[model samples]
Target: MLNQFLDNISLPAATVTSATAEVQYWKEDLGGIGTVRAVNGVEVTTEAQGVISAIHFKSGQYVQKGDLLAEIFAEPEKAQLQVLDAELRLARRNYVRIKALLDRGVTTESDLDTARSTLDQVVANIEVQRARVDQRVIVAPFSGVLGIRQIDLGQNVSPGEAVVSLQQLDPIFVDFSLPEKNYATVKSGLPVILITDAFPGNSYRGKITAVDPQVDSASRNFLIQATLKNPKQHLRPGMFAQVSVQIDAQRKVLVIPRTALIFAPYGVAVFVLEPDENGDQMIAAKRFVKTGEERGDLVEITQGLLEGDIVASSGLLKLRNGESAIINNQNQPPENANPKPGNS
Candidate 1:
């Protein structure tokens, strides 16, 4: 009789947190590693070879378009310009005197013409001299933040030598590549998100601005460009980034919290709660599941789960198949499909 009583003994209910399987729209995420690029970036170079005389801006300085950046030694050119100016003034006076003489019949028209030609020649020479002087000055090509000073004052720089780098940071661009198979799905106006290790836990939102018409021959990947607002100017060119884009139409799928699933060598399973034969207690029943894609804290259930099914989200290890479970959700926080743990 004691052995029979022992066989009929019942175990207490196990406490577990529960989550409900929900039906929601799901989209496919396509992603690739990319590099951040400035919308407008260049190495500010010099056109004239000469020794630097003055550097008007500091390193990493913000400048407007046409702002003076540096100047090359041009004392000789300035002196030459002054001499040309004096010669032009003299030629103008001679031209005026010859014209008056011609009008009074004191000189021939040929003399007046010769004086006029001299005045025109001097004016042209002065203009050429001014242009020569302008070549020695270096100005910003566009409004941007300047990089370090490449050439010091009094240092000689060759023509086409980089003086500094200028980059426009607002509305930056990010270049990425995707497999050519996805070319038809990607185009201008598609939304993209970018994440970088430089700024942890932060993401940038933007849209596709351009897509290469042809795929790369070697890699079979097509190039894609995206534009993002960078008002703080934090994103720098050449920074490594991970970019993702959602493609295809949204479809309805059953979503559940990842904690609810139990993974074994055979397959995945979940503890689904059901009303016991007594009708007053709940029982945990083991059910095999077929999972699809996972995004953030949520997992997609392709099969074995129905909408509004209550499953064990926590305390899975503490419960056995057919074990009784106590519903204790007071400690279980709400489930979020896309959870930002840092914010929490």
Candidate 2:
């Protein structure tokens, strides 16, 4: 009964956190969703169908162009080559003998011509057989990092079957699109920044490499592609990324921490703190404000607040107009224009 009577005459002081309004120059950014892609991507396949005799490359191996990747059984093709070689040697000897006899006028010229023709035919047959053997050997078409191996030694595979995936990781491409209204704002050479959930707190920088010449009729959006350096291959294909580009020059803005704003149905307001007569306790005065754009943890105040003005950042429910405030700022909320949140 005594405590209630004392509270009616003079209310108890409320503890609250405080933050100061400031002017900061920041540029507005154009943001969009993007997808990471490899510069060169393909499923490596063999041209000939046969049993896998030798697996030259392991899974996830980095290979260069023309490097031996795998091999198919070609014992029969190899035997054909050996027989062709022996026949070629015999044909050469017979052609030489016929030429010598014709020069001595001991044999007819027609016999020499026939021998020469026989030698040419055998040489052609050997070339054709060698080409068949080459089709069995699988080699890398380009330099890239290989994916998981699909087949093992002695596992028969058909032609055009994928053995593994190959992708050139360095200098990867990021594909995104913007609305047609922004088509005039974006162009080549503009800087691009990308962030992904896979690697928080890390941002990749690049420049716009290409812009689609025309917008899609269905979506009414134009595609934008940028090239990012990925020497370590940290960025991979099919990764979702958040892309941003600075659209215009920086502009100054008056901002306060979002926590300072008192959200109400009628309007948004804040408790502006002013020194009382005693110069010890602060008087919190409620002032309605007009807000503009919002940054990470800060909100812009277009009206009703002056720069360098102190505002209540916490304890809004307890704060009342004309009430005294004990500014306890030791435990303040996060107040930053740009915040990087972790998955906690």
Tens digits of per-residue lDDT for model 2 on 1-344? 99988778867888999999999988967789999999999998978889999998989999998899999999999999999999999999999998999989999989998999999999999999999999899888889999999888998899898988999998999999999999888989899999998988889999899999999999999999999999878899999999997666787899999999888899999999999998988999999999998888999999999899999999999988999998999999998888868752
Candidate 1 clashes between residue pairs 3 or more apart in a chain or in different chains? none
What global local distance difference test value does model 2 have? Answer: 0.92
Candidate 2 residue spans exceeding 4 A from truth: 1-10, 75-133, 178-181, 197-201, 214-222, 246-248, 264-267, 274-292, 303-309, 321-331, 340-344
Q: What TM-score does candidate 1 reach?
A: 0.72
Off by over 4 Å in 1: 1-12, 27-33, 75-135, 178-181, 193-205, 215-221, 239-249, 342-344
Put down candidate 1 lDDT per residue, 15-122, tens digits, no spaces. Answer: 998989989887777889999999889999998889999999998999999999999999999999999999999999999999899889999999988999999999
Best by lDDT: 2
Q: Predict model 1's lDDT versus the native.
A: 0.91
Please, what is the TM-score per model?
0.72, 0.73
